[model samples]
Target: MDDRNIQYIIQEKFHTLSKSQQKVATFTLKNLQFVGVHSATNVGEKAGVSETTVIRFCYAIGLSGYAQLQREVTMFLFNEGNNSSLQNYLQSKQKLIENPRFYEKTMEKDASRILNISKNLHEEDFNRASLLLHTKKKIFIIGYGSSNLAAQWLYFTLNLLRPKVVLMKLETNEMIRSLQEIDEESVVIILSFHRYFKEPIQLASEIQDKKCEIIGITDSRIAPITKYSTITFVNEQQEMSTIDGMPALISFLNTLIVGMTAQDHDYYEKQRVKYDDFQNSFIADRWS
Candidate 1:
């Protein structure tokens, strides 16, 4: 089997795919392990498409056949953790640094990914998401695994700007208790990326059940959470590595924060002043 990132291939070819093929693509991206193991007929049933359509989707993405598609999916899943070790990470960084133009290449990649955000994310959705964050009585953020850091950054920054911003803990019982407090006036921001977790998807679904607005920050348009999102920002990564996407995701969040602050400059300014005062008086520890 050729070495290609199945998820990237599917995403790149997604727009050109027929609607039925797109369904298969979405399902395949979301459920790679299932696709790797299941028959075309089973995948078809799960994706709500015909078995023939699933086979065609494989060809549409440049795979030779269903067998090659399965191999690609399996290999991608197996290699997901290949660079996860500290030693491997250090070696990768070392190799990059050995290149004379490493800095330029790295910056170029980051710039490209950040620029792609404007293409994948729509202005109307961005404006609506910003407005929702500013107006909602309560805001909750949920993310897991690799997404946790981004979630925490957003929660901390948002709390500085507004009141009642909750960073939902990962514990199921605690999450359920927190969910009880959400209502139509609440807005939930769910951050999920490739190798997506189930908890955030389920939480988004429940938030949808409560008729609350959801701001989904994800890498794919058909990510399960997007189905429940009131507004979604798809920050598709140019590479398979989650680390490569961090700069773009952070940039997107920074823009959202700027938008929220811009909505009421005076109010946010006052809030920041109060925040500084509170931090200086209560939170800071100084050694003189």
Candidate 2:
């Protein structure tokens, strides 16, 4: 879980916390993990505040000491915090009335998350996945919850660019039933983010016995299920105080769709022409 209490601090103490205090708060909210590792002096130095102000900031937040605050920061940064679902970041707020420092810090956090994930998207994995997507007989997807929706979206859209695909829903027994039938030619793509459903990894682990490929779309390298993934693309999983959702992972899926589509020019052109012809013939009749 991610922290839900920070926004309350931004709301209640925005006017009261001095400029230096506000910097401390914004910096902490954005990079809690970094602060957790830094000493009080280092933290204060980074945020352009005094060590006393850092300790005072911790005390202001109901924490006993800077060390206690650091522990909570660790929990939140490492996704071990006993906090509520991260829907606080999904709220809607007008930019005109928003906390500028908080919003800026939120953007910075997203950038850090995205860059960190980019750093982990090993090039060899990308090349291997591109080849797998191009050569695989079929693409089978697995995901539950939000990841399920993303899987469904990928299944529907990728068909326009590739060949056969399947999203054997999150049913474990059914997955096992289907897994037993899939040949070595088939590929599995697992879509999951925070609190990843365990069943996918279990299914993939089983499929590994048959020498099948596994791909993962997840939140971060720190994610629990990542080591099982042959190829994992980590993307920012929305960290704003008022944003609907993260679309970064979808952008990568869309990229793969385009890459596979570009592989064979004639096939792509013929499919586009056929689809356009069908659309022109059928869509206009319904509209008129």
User: Best candidate, lDDT-wise?
Assistant: 1
Q: lDDT score, residue 145, model 2?
A: 67
Which prediction has the highest TM-score against the true structure? 1
lDDT per residue (tens digit) for residues 75-118 in model 1: 87887756563443355467678889899867886889888786
Give the TM-score of each candidate.
0.82, 0.62
| Candidate 1 residue-wise lDDT at 66 | 96
Encode model 2's per-residue lDDT on 149-173: one tens digit a residue.
7788889887766668887865668
lDDT of 1 at 94: 71
lDDT of candidate model 1 versus the reference: 0.84
Go through the candidates in order and give each one's C-alpha lDDT.
0.84, 0.68
N/CA/C clash count, model 2: 0
Question: What's model 2's lDDT at 125?
Answer: 77
